[model samples]
Target: MKNGAFGRDLLVKALYGSFKKLNPLDLWHNPVMFSVELGAIVLTVEFVLEALGYKKGVLWFTGWTTFWLWLTVLLSNFAESLSEIRGKARAESLKSYKTAVMAKKLREPLPDSPYDTVSSTDLRKGDLVLVEEGDIIPGDGEIVEGAALVNEAAVTGESAPVIREAGSDRNAVIGGTKVVAGRIVVKITANPGETFLDKMIGMIETAKRRKTPNERALEVLLVSLTAIFLVVVLNFRVLSEYLVRTTGRGEPASITILMALFVCLAPTTIAALLPAIGIAGMDRLFRRNVVALSGRAIEAAGDVNVLLLDKTGTITLGNRMASEFIPVGNHTFEECVHTAMIASIADETPEGKSIMELAKKTLGVRSDALPKNVKVIPFTPETKMSGVEVDGHSYRKGAFSAVKEYILRIGGTLPPELERVVGRIAMSGATPLVVVKDKEVVGVVALKDVLKEGIKARLAKLRNMGIKSIMITGDNPLTASAIAKEAGVDDFVAEAKPEDKLNLVRDLQKQGYIVAMTGDGTNDAPALAQADVAVAMNAGTQAAREAANLIDLDSDPSKLLDIVEVGKSMLITRGALTTFSIANDIAKYFVIVPSAVSPIFPHLDKLNILRLEDPYVAVLSAVIFNALIIPALTPLALKGAFYRAVAPDKLFVYNLLIYGVGGVIAPFVAIKLIYHLIEFFVG
Candidate 1:
């Protein structure tokens, strides 16, 4: 109940659901609980027989045993029901944001095309919708034309507006977010009920959630233990009859007592809370604004040994800004800044925008209006440069080699200090973009991309936990090495392409490494699919989201660290509770086994370390204790166990002393105290 707290209505619904789960058909999935229910029914019949004067034991004893047995099953049901109710409540809240809105449906993919106004719910895949400023996006889609500043607080919970533009990796947009500035034509990618929000809501609902691989395997172990314990308890009746004949003392174990012993010996504590633990793990991730398509992804995160991260937007601030304008030869700083700003007038990349901002702030230069006969050259992979031609002069800024070749071809000599200046910038982890006007070398703009704060510290923690961190980037070797050293990553791949990432993941997997890849682009889909744990950004392309199992709504690639912690916490909680549950039987055995046989073999009473005076009270007390512990530990199951970064060997020893030893001692004290209270009341 951290983010999705239970309200009065949710609590009432959960209470009702607990009773509804009492149906045998519903309990059938959990074999241990189902067997407990069967035992409760048998005890109820035995209590009625005692009341009708067929008396095999005291009527009050039989009645109390039956009541406790039923309560045990009910508490188990309530734990699971409460977890499911919280999940549904979160789903309802997500649904509230997806209200109907009118969309301007475009007949053609043109800015001024004929359009029809239709409800957002009627939107279909591949439909083009024209959205303007102040209009809410009708559905999840990619911007096909133009760009806008969108407020996506409805889904991401971040109030800052993000820029979504056509022909860029950041073009994807979710429905229910308003277009706060500019206009865009969006091409719908999902049908009305198949949007990202719809998929998230469906995945969180209890009925639709599939059991994770770990959950299924644990359930099998619990069922097998239940079967093994059932055989041991059933054999107790034969042993009791033999003892009665040999000593001519005591009665054969009654059905009520046999049922009580069987329930206590079985691993009921872990089984009762297993489903709740799995549901709570999903709820925790949802609270962090991450939606996991399957529980297996989260479980895999706990075991990941290698993390592959994209360099830009993940490790670094991503937007390279002009930090310095170093002039070459006799050119002044103002001349270099003016040339760079003029060359980037028709550019729209983040680096270009930053250059214009730097120029304006430094020298108050403005290029708001271009001359009527101006011609622009856009940057492309082949050209590696962008520039504009006006008044019979060409201004350009790009990679040093590209700009050098342009000036050389135009019959100009290179500046004497240009090479040294560029090398200094590259060595300092900044990209040096050469600026040239006509046939003369102007200067270089040092576009520096800074590392995200605390990234080095986070990677160091991952290293301590035995997870290797690798950075992948399209930058040259010099820049890549500088950033890798600055971020403290274990390894790096320079000048990497889409297939390079895919091949790296496959190679790491072949070496028996569990790789976790975080990416947010259409080019990242192949690698995301190949990695063991794939986390895609929600703002990424549809292909990336579809390929990855985990989607980060806030689009922060560093969130993978939090995901790993949550996964480890869930696994640790389940393992600790299981250790405690099995250890608990030690105390129950001392309370019930010795008391059951002590009537015929009085020497066996020495095993009753708590020194209970009444056999009937001892058995009843153990049954009540077993029932009460389910609700007592419900909060721990939902909240998860305490976790820290420690060696596996040390962790095992620590848990053994805490939960394992504590579990053995807690029941002895509780059962003895309960027996005394019951005896005083009966007397």
Candidate 2:
């Protein structure tokens, strides 16, 4: 409702010369409907009395009618104030969308979405583009050229720069990722509308739509409880009328007065409490840098026991560096580096650039020559490798799987020892690149991204907190498990596609586990949306930024623990206020009922229950008490107050005791004081 109303307001503000005369108050949001509803109810009651031949004096009816009208107006104003706060908070939660536009300063190229690349302005689908060290990726794609350390925390919830090298099966680049080191060429597989970043942001924007069972149940309870209270109050009025008719006395002035008080105190006071508390809780979260897209997510975050995570950027260092150079073709490491450099001179992949950088570092050689008269076949998903021809000699380099297929097509097989060596490297989470020259396998280079600092210790901390951390990835099982064990992950899923990641979250939710998936790239969008909580990286892809609820402004995986703490604290705070408000109301009923009915407390009944005779005094007292006493006694609502006399779990019981037990004593004391005051005045 908040979003819809805000959206309507936005439309109105944007459209000129339409509904220009209509004030915001003229809309259904004003207090007018509440006043009309209350007035109609009062009139209906008067009509019912007249039909039963029990017409009251004009002053009695007029006073009672006027009181209800004002009561409804007051309640409506309170409701609207809360609603406005919520609307503003909801609008602010989406401030990141504006940031996306600011990201345009990076002048990132658009991926092939609108379908024209020459203009660079018209980024068509399936175009391979390059992102330099200082440039941002314009679209989401697989890294095809150059190895780079990319900060993707904005796109993925995890605050980490992921390293991408060629031939790393899990490597995927997202749009808006800042190239921290090296350069990369990305093959744009998804168009702008279909990009991962867009989907993630869309998910975040829609976060408020989902609701948990508890919140729904609470809503039902509020409605039903308010109705029950109203019925009881009405029944008491009927009983008073019955007593008056049986005694053959004039209708009791006090009964009508009590009815007016009940009307003002019952629905206005109690029903107002529920939504006010909820909106206040939301505002508190907003102030705490927590963007709660939905009440369900906020509630779910408090209940999450096991938080499943993705490994690539979540638990381990996401960047892989070129670490080893092994030569097998009667060639020294220098010779191999030279040959590889020549082969990759015209290449633009991250792994190629990493290899080139290694050659420069090791041999201190620099050359900017692309072999003349060269024919190149760019790597495609089907081929899984790329090849270049220079002076009628063809050289190929790519994944072991692709190389093996090429060898078989030519009726050749690798030596058993060589295959075993590659297998061992692959098992250790390394990408094996088999270099082939003149259709004969020459050597292989194995590379892996190093792990992040203190990841194992962090995983241990998660375990200590009783959180079962699971790693999900698209890597082969051997590679996935190797990284998982090294990172101290409790469980893992390998070779999972994007949709599979999302489905896995759903499955975990069905089993009653709260899941959180972190990805700084476009591919992580769906899974981020699927989870109960979506954490996006401050440096991650546009899709991820759009999809998540919470952004790791620092792009660090460790931030999850901090967010969990914040969410837990927020729930505790909400529980605190809920207990206090309900308890106070319950106590009021006990004290006010006994005090008003006691024969010895005639003065208690004579005193204006709501001080309606003087509207300013009554309203001021109610407002001040609501703003000060109730809020102050609401132990949880107290500013910066933590763990006082009561633990979080015991708060509800404490509040009930104060309101129930203390309430009985409170009214008796008040009545006694009133009697004494009246006697002294008479004396």
Candidate 3:
């Protein structure tokens, strides 16, 4: 839909939601508004009776009062409906990228038969599909063959084209992203209507934003306060009669007095604005290009004590590449470089590809002369090594510890000189991929990955929020420490395997900490599930995405800091509004109760500190002012109260001074002005 049409639809739907709010049963979701709404209903009946000239005089005018009461309820509903309207417009935009198209499916691997053309929806999981340079990826899949530069702008909102190749970590591809160069054979990972983008769109359309724990707890407190006010109003008759006997004044029991007192003292403002606050928070997250599986997860992030970050793909650029070739143990640099190339000949990692290129440039090794039918050992998180075997001669290169153990297993130990060289390289903060041939150490390939720029400042923000950050890596301790110190993380864990990552999360939780893990590797799946707040990359594997509660579409790990702020924004917004709501009641009681009953008592007129022109106008003005404030604060509720990172007590003190004092002062002035306006017009 166009912008104008979307806005028009929003107002219409808001009107409909307002009508639905009139039902008393619907008040269960908004109990604080229930008493005022029911009062408006009763006043509307009196309006009809007074108009018919039945059993009443012009003692009270009910028309404008009734109109103000109901308008308050409708304004609250409209604020919430408008928030969802934004989400609907975004969902429609996502749908445009998924228009139907024909996909070329491969039935056989051999180049013997023509490919079959099938509907995009007909492509099932595990089916192989061929996408040309300009074609959109048929489904969410893993690249199993060929390479391509794919544009992920539709899904991630990034315009840069990323290279995708078979048999590597960056192979995952999303449907609806365009292929910009080369062709790729993708093995579908998701079936029809089950793609990642589909789940994202479904989330927005439903937008079932559940109440955060803080929201729920505050609601219970508000309900209790409402009940207490109800009891106080009920017994005010008995309390007033005692005074009536002594003073010879005070009016008899009246329903209008009870209704006005209940509406004024009860916490209605925040209650009416709670749903709007929550929906707006979700919409804000969506605008940041983050999709939260549940609003609860976003809230949980607010209290996260420990942030667990992966070192490779998250903290660094994640492009581990060969930077230098260092030979050890009396071998020429050329011999070591040639042996490193052989070990990485069949390896497909970016690290492996860089090793091959480095060898050709410096050592003049020819790729065409490399041996064929060689056995390739793929790197695994468990083994932490990759190797090649040609006729019983094993050439390996990987993590230093893994390669060291391999040399010992074959009765050939790493020479002291070679081991010292490995230590020197690792101490330099570069990953030392040790190269070995025939169980003897040959050289070390220094794989360098730079830390992301401006990461330290982001980590500092998390620290101010009372969150401790730790970096976990499979690199040696010296390298991990070097990186951690430069990055300014709170702590670092070196040589961490997949299981070690899971154990760290479990231990932290056992000690009363909320953990948040960010990773893109399948190995991080278990750790992600174990953490309190699991964030996955959009370019990550499907398994990793399934394990995570939030997805960063930009694939930027630094977005976690922003997510923390968003979560805290929700809690702080609700808290400030709640404080303001209750505090405003203090002023309302002064205006409403004295104006309602002081005519008979005359002595109770002392409480009319504002010295209003007329008595009935004071009471009506307080009620109208209270009703009008709901819509007045709607913008603040939707935008969320201004938040700053501080300790809990300090945060409370700050909000208390600002909202509490302001709430009390604002209502008194507004009600007094409204009373003057009523005198000017109606008198």
TM-scores, all models, native as reference: 0.89, 0.51, 0.81
- Which digits, one per residue and each the tens of the lDDT, describe model 2 over residues 114-165? 3323322345466667666776767666765568888764444445677776
Backbone collisions counted per model: 0, 44, 0
Q: After superposing candidate 2, which stretches have Cα over 4 Å from the reference?
A: 1-212, 245-294, 311-510, 520-530, 534-554, 599-683
lDDT of each: 0.89, 0.56, 0.82
lDDT for 518 in candidate 2 is: 63
How many residue pairs clash in model 2? 44
Residues 218-325 of candidate 3: C-alpha lDDT, one tens digit per residue: 888988998898899878877777767777874554555566677778887888898888888888888889999888888888778899888875678878778899
Per-residue lDDT of 390-496 in model 1, one digit per residue for the tens?
A: 88889888899988887888799999889999999999889999998988889999999888999998898888777899999999899989999999999999999
Q: Pick the candidate with the highest TM-score.
A: 1
Report residue 352 deviation for candidate 3 (angstroms). 11
Candidate 3 lDDT (Cα, 0 to 1): 0.82
Please identify model 1 stretches exceeding 4 Å from their true place: 1-8, 321-397, 406-417, 435-445, 679-683
